[model samples]
Target: MNFKKIMQKSMGFYFNFLSFVNPKKLKKDGFELFCNPFARKVKPHQLEFLQKGISDVLDLEGYQIQTYKWGSGSKHILLVHGWASHSFRWKNYIEHLIKNDFTVYALDAPAHGLSSGKSIHVVLYAKVINAFLELHSEIKSIVSHSIGGFATTYFLDQYKEHTIEKVVIMGAPGEASDFFDFYKETLGLTTKSLNLIIDEFYSQLGKLPSYFSSAKFAESIMVPALIVHDKNDLATNYYYSIRLNKHWKNSELILTEGLGHDLKSKELVKQVTEFVLN
Candidate 1:
């Protein structure tokens, strides 16, 4: 087996053993492991790309959020990246937005890029987005990928008062339970172990895993939205976008083939730009 498979097997064995011997410790450790991003290494090119934009750090709830801005257009736009990803992922969209004369903003989600934190969850990420939105109420357009999309929808759902005009969500998971299911399957967690982790999650967040559904959150978000997903996206099933689109009322759905989760194509950039501009 490869290194990843070997690690998964070892983790499964370790957690299973802990479940039988020390259920209390298993809950704490499993919850932490679930929240941990594994911290993707920042590439030199990515760092250089981020440095090109004006940079600032915001201290929010004891976490330092690294933000970047480009262009000086009267209209403002924001970009939110997904799990295990940083702002560099928005380089193509940023270039396109700037060329269209948009003042673009992007942030490194907590624990993902230069931000300070060891762990994160959808609720915490939503709060981070809320804090940034509070500062830049002029930002009316947003483009988000994966979990970033989920957090954005959640923010709009809870806050209910904002200046957001348009939104674009790409390859975002519809249900938070999907993440827990994936984690349980990947680590081969025993039922008891998974239950312990679920309990711990509730203890920390005061909500069940099922509470963070994007489709459910979409019902409350009344802004015009563009939902793009690939039929073959392995990271997040496109069906989630289909489900979210059905409930989003003012949203449009674009189902593409072979683009996978990133959805980084010139054509997609054009579609997103046109949607934001028009």
Candidate 2:
């Protein structure tokens, strides 16, 4: 077998074997690993382009998150990147927002970019956004990619006082349960292990993953939203965006052909700028 298959088999064996010896401990450990995965390392070259921004770190709860501020405009916009992503991923969007006379703020989630952590999840990711909003309440719009999109909705659902005028969710999963399923499948988690992990998650988070649906969160948000999903996206299904658009009362859905997950299209960028500003 190849490396991936071998690793999957090894994980299955390890979890199954541990279930007999110490199931409780295995559940706890597995849940932690499932939730707090090792962050993808940021490359050195990525930092070279970030030299123009004002950078700072925020110590929140158990995480030290890195944030960047660009532009001097009074009105502010926030850019949120997805899993395994850093603030630098917003380079293109930042330029557009700046050109439109909006100050841009981007953050490296806990365990991402310059942040100090081993693992991160949507709940913690939402907390990071909350922390930033606490200080910069003037933020008028937020543009989020992938998991960050779901986290943004989750934050808006909880904190309604913040006056966010517009939102853009790019290539995000609709349901939190789908993500958990993907996680289980990716790690080759046994049924028992999956159940135990779910139980552990409930115990810690006070809700099942199903309760944290992005579609459900969108239902509660009254602001205008633009959801961009490429039909060929492999990581997240395009149908999820369709479902989300249906739930969001005031929203527009843009379906693209070959852009896939990471949208680098200047046309899409222009569309986003028009949607947010005009």
Candidate 3:
């Protein structure tokens, strides 16, 4: 973490914290979209071309799936966006991947983009990914950022590798527990209160679900993994990615400097695409 990313992550945290206290800032993160009658980021970008392609596929179960055909080849690459972001967040990556002649799947997770949930958790995202893999058994690669990166591993833990051949987890935390802890601090909830809330959340579903830790799952991965993490990713705290790489068996790490938690660097995207294709 040089001077720039430190500053950016600091600002993002401060702003996110400010919103947590003020409630108005929560809207900035798209929390109010539940109450609003209109669509947010993912809805507007559900172009005719994308919608028509997914309509021929399996049902969303809880959310909508969008697709775009890149080339005649059958090598499919699934692209997942991060927290508070939509499939459109991968606009740059999608275009590049498409130009490279690979089938692209840019999904909108539940409660995000064009999905139907009012809110979301890592489990739900993993479920959606597994279901999609069940329907399309040719997903050759996965590229996920931040929370979605965690979901990629969660999906693996849930269904035992249905489609994904290899993956690139960019800026994803090594553990969901850390993010949950961060959520508590951001929400001003104590550990006891957080546990109570999570317990209630679990009870609503009628069961306790097992979570995936990237650090643990990395040791069990049979496929290749390349983690691209910036040293300055404050949201995830660079140590998480380092720990994952340490545990992973067939994995490589690409350490960066400028990029923070966003993981939107073109160089990182290109490297990930290359790793997947190779």
| Segments in model 1 whose C-alpha atoms lie over 4 Å from true places | none
lDDT for each residue of candidate 3 in 103-179, tens digit (9 for 90 to 100)? 78777776666566666667777888888777768887889988888888767766775767789988897765565
What TM-scores do the predictions have? 0.97, 0.95, 0.76
Model 3 segments more than 4 A misplaced:
1-58, 66-69, 201-211
RMSD of each: 1.0, 1.4, 7.3
Local lDDT at 128 for model 2: 90
The candidate, 1 or 3, that scores higher on lDDT is 1
Q: How far is candidate 3 from the true structure (C-alpha RMSD, Å)?
A: 7.3
lDDT of 1: 0.92
Model 3 lowest lDDT segment of ten: 30-39
lDDT of 1 at 149: 93
Report the C-alpha lDDT of model 1 over 1-278, residue by residue, as the tens digit.
89998899899889989999998999999999989988797899899999999999989989999999999988899999999999999999999888898999999988999999989898999898888989999999989999899888898899877899999999998887887899889888888889988999999999999998998889978999999999999999998999999999999999999899988899999999999999
| TM-score attained by model 3 | 0.76
Candidate 2's displacement at residue 152, Å, is 0.5
Ranking by TM-score: 1, 2, 3
